[model samples]
Target chain A: MSTIFQDLVDTLRKSTLHFADTKKLMNTLNIIVTIKQVPDTAEVRIDPKTNSLMREGVPSIINPEDRNALEAALALREAHDGTVTALSMGPPQARDALEEALCMGADLAVLLSDRAFAGADTLITAFTLSRAIMKIAKYDLILCGRQAIDGDTAQVGPQIAGFLDLPQVTYAEGLELKKGGSLIVQRGLEDSNQWVQVKLPALITVTGRINHPRYPNLYNVADSCDDAKIKIWTAKDLQLPQAMLGLGASPTTVKKIFEPDRKMKGEMIPGDERQMAEALITKLKEMHVI
Target chain B: MIQLVPEKCIGCKLCVKACLFGGIAVDGKVPRLTDSCTGCGACVDVCRVEAIIASGEKTGPVCDFAAYKGIWVFAEQHAGKLHSVTLELLGKARELADARSAEVTAVLLGSGIAALDGELFRHGADRVLLTDAPFLANYRTAPYERIVARLICEHKPEVILIGATTTGRDLAPRLANRLRTGLTADCTGLEIGPEGGLLQTRPAFGGNIMATIATPNHRPQMATVRPGVMQARLFENKKGETVRIAVSEEPGDGLVQILKTLAREKSSVSLEKAEVIVSGGRGMGEPKNFKLLENLAGLLSGEVGASRAAVDLGWMPHDHQVGQTGKTVKPRIYIACGISGAVQHLAGMQSSDIIIAINRDPAAPIFQAATFGMVGDALKIIPELISQLNANT
Candidate 1:
């Protein structure tokens, strides 16, 4: 698997070289991939007694959508010969996700972890990420998942774009190198899709349709154990004021938490196949579904 | 209670435009707030220089009569048709309305929508507030906000409920900002306190937790409930009285109108109205695998949905994504495949009539909400389940 990946990388490098002097290939590329670690949703269980999710033993993994973002970055790096950096803000355990990105071919990894980063809503999260990106400086591209599985706000990407004052291409499915250091990309809208040409150093939030991410093979997995080196950054490293890192930075706050009211009790309409179908149909009709 | 620093202002006038209440005016090159400034902080978001700050005070006038009343639901309409979520909100509103003996009124706005007044009555509205005008024929944010804001100001309804649809989501925040009240968006539950305060509940922290909020000191506590979260009232064939109000002709131009709107095409999957929904998650592994969900949905005559995970993965379209950032669906039967029931994902579909969870992990949080649970691999079980469903069909 390692040989295949190396061969693929070589092929990509050669192809990119062939396109050299093609105005789009002239500039240096700096790519930032944003990621997160979330509990495997399929493994999470709600404790009946507590009426809350039972998260204790649930396995945590890199957010599935973020994996796509990483793959897109890796592919871009392989083609354009650019540096791909992985960045994440989470608890200490989230370092594991950064390590995975390194194994997937990222050149560098940075984890934004600190107690001061806790209880951040989307607005604060965007503020922190934008500040961090600004500190990183001279990045030609920014890649992010359309939304995180945990928060599902889908606001951070746009909000970050707003903060950075960069034109954003959201829900991108594909990209092509264009003339004059510009990229022609496809953006998926609600009713239909449209293509836009954006100058370099732009922010893009990707949807899942871009590419199939390659799995880590035995050799890469083994090498990852030795090669993985993550740079840990805190509020101080990013040079952000203490008040702007966490809950205090967030304008919106969650005032209380409660279980939603369940109006109808689940009733099992049981019987043989035909009987069950009839019962289901009858129930649907009674509920005005017909 | 939001304040702006004059020195830092770039004279962008974004705050002036964001102020729903016409309280802030641009004086030469600076934004000036009046005594009518409600302190809602709606203008704070438009400050590019971070000049506007929330003062954290209850700075608005206290409507004494509104303090004693209960919650109210505004039934929104478009093109003379009442939005389906209106009835759903009425059902939820009835509960809170009954708690405080507060009458549930459905505020209808549109030209010639008075004929549909009986529909709201049958669906549980005690009174219908009607405002008809040619300007309302199309949903322009300014006109709708004006009528709704005027009604709230006049009637002094303690609580206002609106469906979190495109129109509702757009109008609610503006109205709340104008009224100097707090608004909870995409709420799934609502409760009234003994003091007639509204406890608005919604999923937060990416759906990891549910948050209940209230405006303790504000009147006309506002909330926007997503469609399908609340059950629609059983319809009865009865008419209710309609009180008509005059529509204003003044057009407020705060923003640019660059493009004319064309006719919108109908969506392929109206999951919002589906009786059964079969949704997939990242567990499906790849975009190509979403075909299985589509096939299963076809057999069941249901709509296909995806968690924000799957949608973000690009396996499905954003329109099919169900969550806080995506569309909220309340089907009668929701079959979750490889969906871990993340708080964000569950917030969108938890109100379904029957939930069926299919995952390898028996401890999947979706199982807690599922009425029937099949603890096994979705890839393996879905094919078999699809076959069984097909045979029965």
Candidate 2:
């Protein structure tokens, strides 16, 4: 990991000359990036024993797109001489993700964890996160991953922006701070790319296409593990009301959770490779999909 | 918190079977809630003895249920053309409306796009709430959210359906929060519950599981369904009344300004639009081996796609990746070559009209999602396929 980080740093050092000298700017951005720790869903499996998701050994990692969001925040800070706060809401185990963020050059890391925060849906989660952001109090921009793989809702960022009543730009593939306190963001839409300019104090959710997240530096990784560098906050820290904190506050309840019904299974084609190829072609032709 | 009423406990262990998370276990005579319990209420419904309950679960209507009426679809339009998802949503809204005996309304927002209302009407909208303004011509978060939130505040539609497209995903959440209502995202299925609530069902955990959700206590229940998940039926000559919502010509707040919109380059195949997709994965061996997939895609007039493994290995571009971290594609025919289908990869393409898997291992999970499977070396079989195609065409 350190070798990759070193190589990327060397390449980035060479490319840094091409950018404008942002140090001349009158004011710099204070950015907050929201991240989540999720089970690497790629390797997640259903356990035959309990018929439940086999998460016993599934590795937890900073959500893929959240890394991109952190990279965006880090890049901005590097260019403009600002601070990047990596904030997260999850169980205590989520500190690993925040540590990774700090190792990747986040100036500060805050983990919001408490038993009262369990079982919150997207709305309540966003509400709780918004309250935490309020406690952080000074932020020119808020960045988040488009969605977490566990949920796949892509709702939290915009919902947070909603609770804060801030303008938001989602699916951001690229962003740059401009003169006059405006942010120029390039959004990757379904069929097109849109360029929008929003003022500071807005929220942006970045996609993985935005940038390659840098690996944590070897030295930074060691330092990031120091407990003093990480702050743990609970529901009381954010002054959240009991009625607004947990499962009870969440309006949407999960009525059921089950393995996806496999309505149709593929028929295995028989015979040798040549015959199999020929058979597939015949079926495609018959379906008029050739 | 999940609770068990000891007096009512029968300990049938049905709740244990119902819980997908293994949150409940029958200990001796009574079932006990474990720390893993998410309070999802799956156990509560399965308990025949009514012993389990998620205390503080909203059982009564939190808001006046009689005040809210009508089913509304946000008729998303871009450059004066209605997005097909809007029509699909209208079809869904029509079904939902019929279930509850409510009127279907399409909320159209654009400048000089009243002509699109006719299409909404033909697609099962009983009414069109037209909000035409210069500022509303293109989608910007602030103005659109403001207007839509205002309309919802005034009209109080019992349910609002929006396509989970780029704009809708961005708009709906903020609007839902502003209205202090629950909004389910990327719902693949929606139905009126016995209590007249919208039961929204969507895939979760990288599509390993399906979760049904409901906002039991919120008014104007909201949900966003992804495009292509719902079918749009045309009801030709269906008539509807248009109610004009006058908006100020001036831009509100001026927080965001649209600079430009660029259509994606035509050189790259649009994976979502492609009818056929030939995908490669880790088993393809090397980056150079992708040429086989490229050739196959060219012959089939399809696009080439890749699994996350191939992309992570630097064998393919990120845009070509199909998985939870990549694009979700539902082509008519998806050919998976040398791919061991992980749940994440399956989440993206399991909805394809037909899936053909080619792998050397018959036991590979990809076979489960395939419409037809062949256990063989993809590198050898692909060449055979190419040669055979040459002979035929």
Candidate 3:
């Protein structure tokens, strides 16, 4: 068992003993949270000629969905005693997001950063994260946001589960503790919902509806900045091959990025109520809309 | 000039299944590309076996015609009811077809949906291609793709348009993959080009920028439009005709089954479809504070919504979230509270009829887009607005 998992188990056992009713308390609870620092999506701009993102001056922050995932983990910690560890892979600045996680209530933070870990697509990203989790050794549950706001691929969680050879319950809305070391979770499917039970050490990706995250207090924020003990590991430190860490490991590459030209000026029809309706109808007819 | 390595082929046959041009064939255990391949790389993404490679070279049959021939719209229907977006697309298609002196054809597919044929023609389809099959009843991936691809192949329409719904998203990619054609998804605007091609425009980079794409080299340029973005043409008195096509007898795996569907109790209003929306943000403070937004929405006969910030804070459900990650809405009136108007949130509701911003921060970005701006606390402004509205009522 990994140290973090053992610590989580210990915390759960202690809580169970304190409660004095194993039947009432949930068993085998541990949370592994996946977080990422993406360029603030609101601040991103595109160069018209290149059609590529103008990333400069855009501040990076924890992805909103990832923050929700962290909050879900924290809520689980509060409801049923367990340890929450934050994990991320990016440049050195990514440590800030993990630190924010610690300040928010994460017991530990892990940074997977190195030059070789750059330019990773979702597949390579999930692979590296799964490998890092394997190295961490102990975790009863894994949690991530459904998708990153920037890419909007919604592929990482499922890909990571595929890499780790684990059954995944994605788009999780709610979680409940079951008696036999299993979790009953409500998953959101398109047009419907499903409830599934999975054993310990399962992976789940949470949507924004899962839980409301609490804001960090002044003391916790101060402690997060001052009492920093973030464990930083490179591909070498994790014993991962260099080829499997970065662009070399990634299967997909963006060949070109260009702005699509807008041929017609999207005109907004204007006038008073009757005139407006008439103009809209006339415009539609003129354009052969009818 | 996409390439497929025989050695790398795991024989998942996604490329074979996706090829609309019929340019690829499964030879025992590998996919073999032919001279008709257009190098669109639609198959590259779906090939889990990673056998298909995009060489990025243009080495297929170049379209010989300088002038486009026909205008097509990928007509979308659900539960025997055609989406208004499809009619809206027909409106746009009618414009393009008139400009190019081409014919407008709407492609309809589903089981026993012939009753909708007359309605489709009345909404501007010069001709309708109907395909009925039991397999296409519930919007399954494989059957819809097969029917749409077959129609496109047979009819050879110059341009094809589909609404960017869940069904359209799934079908377009697969059809594009099969046809070796270019497809642009989530287009907010579209125009017919001088060269008789399509100018497909959509927001990219997390809705930070708008991109207009064109498929100059491929026939039947494809694009998907969002619902409510385009204006649907009013019904006309002119008569039109429908042609029914035989459904193919190809067997589908049907690996995924719908065991049961439980309609979630419609709790709050659906923000995307609501005419009026009142959205709250982190500025509202605690989760309890969101009730003011709910009250305001109720008074306005609107739906309560939240920015990604409020949703992230767990103050509201994800369905009510208005941002890039959530639902895109175009309501008649959208009142934002305490929301700083993050670009993601703006992208979803920027097209609203009237925008009202209530924020303590004078420099909030929402002010730029708002028709009415009040520099005050949302907690204070909300109750006041509610009382004023009550007085009027």
Candidate 4:
């Protein structure tokens, strides 16, 4: 055969194989991603007089690490045929986060919002989310961000695993679905990396290093704004005991919030850039810091 | 439920300002609770006229606080070495235990690691609870959870402290849920309250603010403290008794399997161990600019650290990040180059003995924490400083 003809035949054969692989039912997975809408921490400030958080102008964004988790779930679904459900427990405004997840290609979005869930700590939040997860019971995997920026507790995902009686892996940066019903995950530990394998129906919490989240599709952005694709659930919708739903059910309570003392004021070097550098070096030597 | 007593309402609107959640509106002559009301009691505490009444909706079986006693530290170990945080926690436990006239018990788990009990005692443990088993050698969530939960049920510890390392973060929450108790994470301070409750103080909102939390109605009040946040002391010549608990055979292979572990390189010390750290952030502009930071760090015989923004921007690895989500460091010196010093970053390195901040923005928050502040471009300043130091040598 001619060289051009031979190349054409090979390309055609590769496309045929790709089509066959997609048609075959293998390694399908159902994934649920748990996300949170957190106020942009950089913009968070405290009201000096009231000594409370000044959240007036702070914009709420999808928790950064949770975006990585959603990206991991979307990538998994692309490789294997499955559905990705994005779930969150917060105020009604949390629907904005789920809608963004929908724009990112999540098959379904759920918002568990109610006044009763307002003062929930990590444990109550986990209980509320786990109740929703049980309601959407057809899943082989659950993914969550390692922690939310606002609370920084990092307890909800593991607590959800506890509530659902599922095995869990935390701080996952890499994931691979095996041919069988197991997943190999690389967990980012402090000062080390650990690879572990767990069967299906397990939960994994992902760190920000896992993958960069893709921008939401513009078309999906418009469609995602439609209220039909997003489902809202209150404390009553989950049918969980009110005792395990909110402030009263929480094991931990916040006694007070205050600003840490900032008493130290440094001496600012007064000079041009080059002059400041020279002065800094001299001071360092004087203090023996260098 | 948050209710306003209209008869006594002065309508000072102090409650409105105190409601962090924007739950109260003073639109009416008296404040009315909105759907946003979380009943956090912030408004109730501020209402000097006693106009607001906050009543929490009670639920669940009440805990019998009297039944629980003694303080427990989950003494974590890797390979054959005990984590330094374990000692720090034991020290804090010793302080709390001393206040209550209670004993401090260190729960040590690992195969053939009973030898660690001596160090635990020297660090302030009154007793050591050892569980040595082949299955317990590695920290798989299920087995460790089962063993630790079983021990807690049997011993009835009043307070439990775990290091907020990866392993502790994984294990503490599961145990909390299984026990149906409350747990606080990454606490900076732990103290016994006037009402005999464990007051756990931790940073929230990305370390922009601090909140004091309490497990008021739960037994075995648990909190995870990050390393270097607490001081570790030695009791020199102190001794404690060790009770070895037998482990039953696990029913089957665990749901998860450990494939491999890549231990950190010994030559590259962790940021927490570095005496000096020259750090960079978003203001470094690009990935290549981090080289200047590396050069400065090399000259100072120190390591290079990155703010979360630099790490997230792929300018540096996650291991180099210093912030609320990263390793807490208290180095002898911390040089923040072109870093704006987010509160999260300050939470990690502000405790350093000396801080030097170099940023173009005079308003950068890092300056507030710096012992020395230079308002200039880091790119221009670092090279000049490097040449100057080189000439000095």
Candidate 5:
């Protein structure tokens, strides 16, 4: 077994470390920031025949929100003592994103690549990530972007938490570590922002407003390109369940994902408030919209 | 498994004629699925060539929730109080369950919420699964996760509804993952479909389309219902049974401890939660001028909002700014005042139910997108409109 996997087995066997003893057991936090290399959504097109994303031609970027997640992890490293690991599950070309993350100061980068993982959706993606995270370390925390731009599902991070039986906070805009191994986070939900305190060994999917990402220095960029230390783990390396690796493992499939017709090409109404309001309300009433 | 290899298919009309469900139709040289084809091999029967293959899908462990029979909702709590969205979910779930001839059950987890089980029933639950633990007083994932996962595994409800609050968002996925079940997030609508499947509908692609998803193969279909979309029906006198279960997972083991919970302070009109909003832009001119919009908003019982340009010019506070850099609002009505809208500003409020733009510049892009538009100055038009509204009301 890999030493990282062995560490997890050892940690599990040793019993839960008390908050007081945790600081002594590991002074530095081990954080794994899960990211994805999604095709630039701005140029997204769907293959009508296949109903799959046409990811060709549109260059891939480290998912925009993942950049904020990486920035959050980096900030956590700056505040506390820890190494941030950038991890992704995608095709072989996903290495480019890992390289970019390394340039942005991720301490270690790992990629889980295999033809078996190609059609994995959020559930399977989370399963694959949890396996890699276990192989990486008995990490104290896992961070992810709120959602990838391509799928925009916001499911993977929390799903990973489920697989690992860990606590999760999604849409986190602010995060901080408390004195006794607790994590304080500002979660931005659909309607409100809430401050929550969660115990360690948690996962947080950060929102884009969390932090301003820093551009990597030229030296670091070239260095990461030349000496990129990305560990590639496949199904065999993780020794995961075969059913959970590919499409066969997926519990749900996209029946269809065509763009909807929500576009409103508004028509200008010539009138003042009395005329416009009455006319508009009348139209809305006619449609039973009001 | 099905593959549509455009190159291999010889544009044979045989498969088109062979499809039983009319799922396939010829679109130019290639065949396109006019409807959702079941991949039932009818087309493969008459392909006359190797182009169509009967690919078998490996059915891995059919852990179907089909055996489950009751509809369940997770009554969400914050700081020991139940949320309104819980009621919303229960109302919707109760309707769906009644349609399927199933009972509505609610799972309540908290320190001292047994007495509150009545509240769940009042909102529509027929039964309550109450797990009260000292550790459950605060919303922590570990304890709640164990109870939810265990309850689902044991009871095997036909459908589970959860309010898509922050707590539900975090807790639902973890529990669903543990159950190895499918969950639809941020769903706006739910109904019982064929074979008692939960038809979960939600907006996708930036609210451009509404997608209805179902978990036919999985049992106990789960959905996280969005708040405010569903009505919260309350009964003066309600009936329900409370079942207590012993939780196996200890509370504190969830390594994370809550030291403090800071709820976001809503001092003034939060643009996000407001039902109606009237926003001003830089064209309103001055900080004092915002009062005119506020007066108009008061007459309409709405909140005053600001465009990024107005906020940037110190006419209004930054907290009120609406755009890409600001909070997105989905109010019932959005009225833009003197605002020549920018794309960034439009992105924020375009999703509102009704958009009314009042700008002197008829050429402004906002006019093109507004549900109603008027070419006039805010200084002259809004006061007259407010006076007219006041006189009418």
Candidate 6:
């Protein structure tokens, strides 16, 4: 066969496969939204002695941006008539955030909790998540928050994409499904916004600006926690190797943690607003800033 | 652990060019693995067709990490413009490089931006590796990661730094994954550690704690520094050599398309540039009341800032937020109005020269750090202060 004939055949073959894939994608979306439960950052505090967050009394919530991820998955499901699965990795208590996702109308909730998964860094976390994702097959889309408020590392989603070897669109602020299972997305960057087109079976890390998550209903919250709707998976359940899912698998280790000293003893100017404002402006003048 | 989904390949030899081990061979449009494959996943990224699986990867001992020399910075450029964090990294990198008698190299990839290489040297880089190609105009993860990873494999650098901006957050992880190396993100401090490894210190657990991380066994220790965290060395008149690499212009995988791009940002009064920042919180009542802070800022020639609460309340935009999740500001004076000084809010602005709190509650945490504290209604105090400042100025 001529080289031109072979090239044409390859292009035609790829296009037809994509066209049929799009037909299936348009009708339904099997979406997995990954979320992390974190200590409410507002009340977060660090122990000066140990140099770590004092999570003892601090309450945990779904990491702020993860709500946007859940909202994105729910929106896609609402538009395409499909199942939305909320997946979270944390201690057993992290199940609360997954239940919240269920309350918000997710079809399935999963909590990957086990003693073995403790102290796992982003790389190990991505490894464990990818194993579960692959085990639960037929997922067409994966959504994640831009970053976790606790770890503050945005690496997991992209690392998961790397593990699964899938194309990824990060900072996905807007999305529109196109014909043939392709998607038009608006990505918010540091300086400007960019619109890009990507195909299905893709991963996206969304920012909080993407959408305001809907509140969970009172009745739905009760139903979501029902045993039939939520499943708890351990390392063995996912058949994940013991060495690959925990602190032993982590590549980076913290040598030390310390509280940063940001305090400065300052002279308090006592007074009402009028007197304080006068004194502040006077001090600015004394410092030659006014 | 490295495998290839042969069906995903498009007969592209880009991966063949990427692999330094000479282990990936293409025949009949499919890649076959060889015993020599070092499992260095560099080819994983370049194969935008997503054919290479570098996962389940457990690193077997790397070549002596000490063999890598020189400190390199990824000089980020967008639309022919450079990010300031690159200059900051160059400044710090120069110090580390000199301490170890190593050279400082800047790795820059963008179309038609090689001409800006001289600026990199003025800031501290000894050499700039320039890769220019039309396909490099818009920042795509695969192409950019491939070029950098391929270069790192060829010319091993002891340390690599990237800006922790949006592009950095997206690209750095992919590069680290491809190299199967350790990456520390949003590092505020970088120092040469014991045994010559790079010690990266960053605020972890929501800025409540600082964690010092070290990559003891990884080559080309990689870290991303957030913009404004490090001071950029002042530019000097100096000449630097540039080594240009010829990049292939082939459209990568054609997996993602750039449908449209918004233009560059307009120049606005940024909180980072403000010397005096007068910020309001939810106690400001409504968005319209923010005008009081704006008026005071105008009289003081400062910027009006907001707490995450105000931004969340829709009283202000996220850009105006001054907190952990928002822009960190080190203004000369930060006046708080009705903000209770939540830890998240204080994490971004506690470095100010002087803090003044104006909450009605005397026991608000904002008063703890404030040089001056006032007990009053923010609504009444703000308007009166705005009138007083306007009258005085």
Best by TM-score: 6
lDDT of 6 by residue, B61-161 (tens): 25566679999999998889888888988999998898889999999998899888988989998899999888888888768877887898789888889
Query: Where's the lowest-lDDT run of ten residues in candidate 1 chain B?
Result: B253-262
lDDT of 5 by residue, A105-197 (tens): 787788999988877756678877876776675688899998776555678898887656566778788998989788888876544666778
Model 3 residue runs over 4 Å out of place are: A1-147, A151-191, A194-290, B1-19, B22-69, B193-196, B216-220, B272-275, B391-393
**Tens digit per residue, CA lDDT, model 3, A1-290:** 12243244334434533222122223346678999888877666555456466798777778878988999888877777777879999988787787678667777788999999997755568768877887777778899997677766555676665455454666778877667667777766545566666666677778776877766543343334433346888988766556445765453343334443322223333333334334433443464412
> Which wins on DockQ, candidate 1 or candidate 2?
2
Writing each residue's lDDT as its tens digit, candidate 4 over B1-393 gives: 666888788877866754544678886557788986655554654455557765555323235668799999999999979999999999999999998889999999898898999999999999999999887888888878888887987778999999999999999998887666789999988999998889999888888877899887778799999998888999999999999999875753378999999986753647888998999999999999999988988899999999988998889987799988877999988999989877778888988998999999887778889999998899998998888888888
lDDT of candidate 3 over B1-393, digit per residue (tens): 677888988776766665556668778787888876656454553455547765534332245544446888877887798988899888888888888888889988888798887787777788888888777776655466667778777677788888766456546644554454556666677787666567876666676656666766566677777666777785677567788888765554242223334656665567767878989999999999888888877876789889988887778977788876667788878888899876667777878876777788866767767755666777876776666556645
The order of the candidates by lDDT, greatest first, is 4, 2, 6, 5, 3, 1
Candidate by candidate, in order, the iRMS in Å equals 7.2, 7.2, 9.7, 7.3, 9.2, 3.8
Which runs of model 5 end up more than 4 angstroms from their true locations? A1-27, A39-61, A79-82, A149-152, A167-201, A232-242, A258-268, A271-290, B1-66, B246-254, B270-275, B279-295, B305-333, B336-393
C-alpha TM-score for every candidate: 0.59, 0.83, 0.62, 0.83, 0.72, 0.85
Compared with the true structure, what per-residue lDDT tens digits does model 4 show for residues A1-290? 12233244335434533211122323468899998999888778656466567889687888989999999999999888888889998888777778778778787889999988889988888878887887887889999999988888889999888767678999999999998889999998876889999998899999888998987754455435555567898877865446546887788889998776555578998898779888888887888877
Give the whole-model CA lDDT for all candidates, comma-separated. 0.69, 0.83, 0.69, 0.83, 0.72, 0.79
Off by over 4 Å in 1: A1-255, A258-290, B1-70, B234-238, B262-267, B273-276, B285-299, B322-332, B385-393
The residue-level lDDT of candidate 2 at B391 comes to 88
- Chain B TM for prediction 4: 0.82
- Across all candidates, the chain A TM-score values are 0.83, 0.85, 0.82, 0.82, 0.76, 0.82
DockQ of 2: 0.34
Q: What is the lDDT of residue B44 in candidate 4?
A: 52
Give the DockQ (2 decimals) of all models. 0.12, 0.34, 0.10, 0.35, 0.17, 0.34
Stretches of candidate 4 exceeding 4 Å from the true structure: A1-28, A43-54, A219-226, A272-290, B1-62, B264-269
Worst 10 residues of 4 chain A by lDDT: A16-25
Docking class of 4: acceptable
